[model samples]
Target: MTQLETAMAILMKVFDQYAAADGKTSSLSKAEVKTLLEKELPQLIKQAKNKEDVDKLIKSLDFNGDAEVDFEEFVVLVAALTCSCHGRQGKK
Candidate 1:
């Protein structure tokens, strides 16, 4: 696979790995999201001022009003974070 294909596959795999934690196998529960952030993106979690802020961040990512994050919504969050990080790197 090309780099982009590999990246997309990795994204799906990661989402599935976390999303499966709650037996949902499709969407990520809030707890699963928190665990993902804390384990996979510790810096992002650490930057938050407190647990409430982290909760709010996760809540904000739930765009479908379902109280859980589907793969599409998770991709949006990942893409946004990727863009944010890329932009920061460009500024340096």
Candidate 2:
């Protein structure tokens, strides 16, 4: 997949699984996304206008926001930003 795909995957994975206190069964609520943005990806999540923006970002990455993303999703978003910080790079 491409870098955009990787990043989307990461965001989706976090929202779909890791972001939730209850585990991977639901999406991150708007408030939770804001908190995470303030902490984890302060820059990206900061620009988010509203739930719509979050939904857009999420769907853009998921390409449909099917509910979950995997490691590949992470790569797409990070790669899109050219963060190059994640050790995984891509794949797996």
Predicted structure with the largest lDDT when compared to the true one:
1
TM-score of each: 0.91, 0.47
For each of the candidates, the C-alpha root-mean-square deviation to the true structure, in angstroms, is 2.8, 8.6
Per-residue CA lDDT of candidate 1, range 50-89, in tens?
Answer: 8899999899999979999999999998988998988863
Candidate that scores best on TM-score = 1
Error of 1 at 63 (Å): 0.8
lDDT value for candidate 1?
0.92
User: Residues 1-92, candidate 2, lDDT per residue (tens digit)?
Assistant: 89979966666666555446546444444445445556778767667777678767655655445554444554566566664465555546
- After TM-score superposition, the amount by which residue 59's alpha carbon in candidate 2 deviates from its true location, in angstroms, is 1.6
The 0-to-1 C-alpha lDDT of every candidate, in the order given, reads: 0.92, 0.58
**Residue 13's C-alpha lDDT in candidate 1?**
93
